[model samples]
Target: MSRLAVAGARHVVTVDPDDTVLHDTTVVVEDGTIVEVRPASAGPVDADEVLDGTGRLLLPGLVNVHTHLPMTLLRGLAEDVDLQGFLTRVWAAEAAVMDPPTVQLGATLGALESLLGGCTTQLDMYFHHDAAHRGALAAGSRHVTGPVFLDGPGPDGLTWQAREELLRAWPAQLAALGGPQVPVAALPHATYTCSPERLAQVAATLREVAGDRPALLSTHVSENAAENADVAARYGRTPTEVLADAGWLTGDLPVVVGHGVHLSDSDRGRLAAAGASVAHCPGSNQKLASGALHWEAVRESGVRLGIGTDGCSSSNDLDMWQAIRQAALLARLTSGRPDAASAHEVLRAATLGGAEALGLGDVVGSVEVGKRADLVLVDLEQPHLTPVHDVHALLVFAAGRADVTDVVVDGEVVVRGSRSTRVDTPALLARARDRAAAAGAAAEAS
Candidate 1:
């Protein structure tokens, strides 16, 4: 068992329901779980490793509830293209050229970027998700992966048969990890891409794999305007209504709907009633020209909200700090109310809210004793973050990715001094660059 201690932090934002902040505190971790969080008066306990959190703001590690990890290979490839043009020109081209090794390499690089930026956990959806799982493990970060299921064949021949095989193999693969194992979730892609029959099949597959245990279900919903219109045209119902009709909202299964930007009032009510959660990707939505999400309405409807970067391909970065800042700004802009989303609320959405969305709230998310010791230390000595009057405000508004000095996940120091401890950054970047060059060549040839 590994023992670690983090001491002398100016403030530790727990993000717990009580909104507690311990000043000049110390946190002790044993065997990947937090054992104690007390004031400096508790004294220094024995530990194999000691993290100096002096002049730093210690907070729970950020959780990204929705992302496409391997798409890091396609970052900035469609910068000037609209959503449709991007899907047709950039995404289609890259998907055709992405192979297993490239996918794994890209995912590994993406994980490294996330870790350096203070993200410890990410819920990822993409083809060849097994490689993504391996990449996350190799990077020493926690991730939940699911094979994307669509009506037609996706990259890597993600047909219905392949989807079933992936689902069947996921549990044992996760179990082999020894600890919590990277849990598997079911991703149906979207209502526009999957048929009603395929949606029902996805639900059945989730039930089969879960079998008296809780499971996660995620899908893109109301992400694009055309998707909403198409659903209504085909089924005479909204996307949420169509999903409900297909029984995708049933059971005790946890569902995370990504990009609920254009959800109607009834849809919001249904999501609240079904206890479903939403992943608000403000950066991606704004980048793709998708309308702003109704953050105020969603919160008032009692729906849990999590922040996501979506993917490097769309948002062009995996930095959760940027995502957090963007989410706060966008929420305020959309609501037209200066007090709509406070810094504290945005930070909570990035941490505990994301954990709840992914069904891991009981184990991780906050700095409570007995919870997993997944935390980040932000350097408060930076010029931009100087003279911090409000810790939460500085965290959400002023802090950038470079402010993340150290990150610990599962009692392990995965990132120290804003660098990855598990991965070779130079080698990973070289491999990723090589893969991207090869993919670009292939795209041109095709």
Candidate 2:
């Protein structure tokens, strides 16, 4: 069995059930699972490879519950626009530039960026999903992606019948594609794009294909006031109610709603009762002028909450550290209480909450024995990170992505010394630049 260890961490933020913090710790991994979290004084550990973690703060790899990985090529293309206008411009660009090969390229670039920033898992929703999956896997990300359903022919040009066939073939295709951490997920675009009947059909298809394994059902919901109004006019109910009526919020299948910026009190109650989770994308919401998701209200309503960076097109980057800090600060501003969303609560929302929302809680959320060893080491020797009085507070209020020095997914070090071990970064950046230029020209022509 392959063995690796991260030894002598200054502080291990376990993020366990009790939020345990260990000093001078060594974490041992064998065959991709955490075997031991030992003390530094507990004697030397036997391992084939060991990474020195001294002067670092060890954490569970960050999780992003909602993102369109292939949209990295469209970053800054749709800025200063509302959700409706953003979609109009971005969709046109996608039509011009987002073929399967380009999708893979963009997904690879996005995944590389995310992984280098210490985000190990991404619940990505995008077109050409097989290509996106391969691209993210190439960057060593625990990518959660599957078939996407749309009301009409989308950029990929699949007919409704073809989409159904693709959904039916998803399980076998996912198995063959082979991401050990990937789950079976059904991503319908959104209520406005998919009718209620189509939503029910998609749900049934997901149920049939997923069998007894718990599947994830994710879609956009109430991302802005206009979106909510449109959904209400179309279906005579809020987006949440439309989903509930379609049988999506039934708790039988795990549900993750992306950018729930306009969810109502009643909607929050239903989601909490149904055991669904909301992915709060504060950066995108703020940039697009979408109303804030009442962070305190959502949590007080008993709903599980997680944080996300929607897509680079709207949010401008995939930086979970920024997202975490924004989430905490935005909560305070919206809730009118300084202590509303505490540092510990927002940190958990970024880590364990996101993992659970993706239905990978049992696999990779915390630094616990028997879990897959997806970990990150943040260099705390910097001036900005100096004098760490409260670890969680420091992480939430002060830390940034540049502090991430190493990242490991499934016990393999994909990033060391802030550089990727999987791909050539300079080459990837050049390709992304070329692709982005093409995308820009496409949008201009359109």
Candidate 3:
């Protein structure tokens, strides 16, 4: 039995049922599952691998529920634009250079960056999904991705029949592209890009693929006023109404709405009644000047809320720490209250909340015995993290990606000493720069 132990932690912030915090804890893992979380004073643990956690804070690895991993090549391609303008520019650029091999290259770079920054799971949405999945797996991440549906020939030039074939083969494809535990996920681009009929068909296909397993449906929803208006113009209904009409809201699968920034009062009620979750991407929303998600209203609506740093093209980075901080601060600004969203609340959204949003809550959300060991160690010995008053506050407000010292996914150390162990960092960055330059040239030529 493979065994690993992380001992002598200053604190183990378990985002568990009661938000338990243990000081000087040692967590033991066997064959990818956590077996014990004891105290440092309980003596040493025998294991094949040991990670010293002195002066470090252990946390459940951050989950990014909404991302386009392959878009790392277009990091700065669509700056200073709203959602509509941003999509137009990005789509044009994507068509210019987003082949499967390039997608794999960009995805590897993005996954390596995410792992080094302490995020271990990503629910990614993009075409050429098989390539994206392979790329993330190469970086040793729990990448949850599957077939994507689009009404017309999108970036990958897939037709309607090809899309269906891809959906039908998704389960086997996912099994072939092996990695850590990952849930089946289906992504429809958005209400504006896909018609209501196409959305229903996509839902049906996902049902066919999932069979007896739990699955999730994620899509862009109500990201901005203009998007809602566009959906209304096309379908005579709001994006929420369109999705509800297609049975996605009330379907057997749980829904994860990306950037519900313009959700109306009635819309929030619909999502809450259907038990759907919303991925609150505060950084992307603020960057694009999309309206803010009402923190108090959504909380009152009883909709599960998770935080995400949207695609690197939109948010410019997959830093869950920044997403956590932006979410907490935005909640205060949007609710006009000092205590609108607490540090613990936002941190939970990044960890357990995000896991729940992706329908992997029971698998990788918290630090519990029998759960998969996806964890992060934040070095509290930094000058900026000195004299920690509240652990949650320090993590949400003060800690940056630079403070992450080690990361483990599925009982294996993928990152140590703030570098990815599974990736060649220097080579990945070089390829990313070269690909981005080529994409720029291709776009200009087009």
**Which ranges of candidate 2 are over 4 A from the true structure?**
none
Which digits, one per residue and each the tens of the lDDT, describe model 1 over residues 252-282?
A: 7778999999898888888878789999999
For model 3, the stretches where C-alpha displacement exceeds 4 angstroms are none
Please give the RMSD of candidate 2 to the true structure. 0.9
lDDT of 3 by residue, 1-446 (tens): 99999999999999999999999999999999999999899999999999999999999999998989899898888888999888878888888889999999988988988998999999899898899999999999999888788888998899988988887888888887778978778888999888899898888888988898778888999999999988888888889999999989884677999999989889999999988989999999999999899887898898889988899889999988898898999899988998998888888989999898888899998999989999999999899999988999999889999999999999999998988888888888888898899777765554
Local distance difference test values of all predictions, in order: 0.85, 0.92, 0.90
Q: Give the number of the best model, judged by lDDT.
A: 2
Q: Could you tell me every candidate's TM-score relative to the true structure? A: 0.97, 0.99, 0.98
The sequence of per-residue lDDT tens digits that candidate 2 reaches over residues 1-446 is: 99999999999999899999999999999999999999988978889988899899999999999999999999888877899999989999998889998999999999999999999999999998889999998999999988888998888888888888887888888888876576789999999999999999999889998897668999999999999989888778999999999989778888999988898999999999989999999999999999898899999998899999999999999999999999999999998999999988999999999999888899988999999999999999999999989999999999999999999999899999999999988998888899889999988876
Report the candidate with higher lDDT, 1 versus 3: 3
The candidate 3 region of ten consecutive residues with least summed lDDT is 437-446
Give the lDDT of residue 374 in candidate 2: 94
Q: By descending lDDT, how would the candidates be arranged?
A: 2, 3, 1
Q: Candidate 1's C-alpha lDDT?
A: 0.85
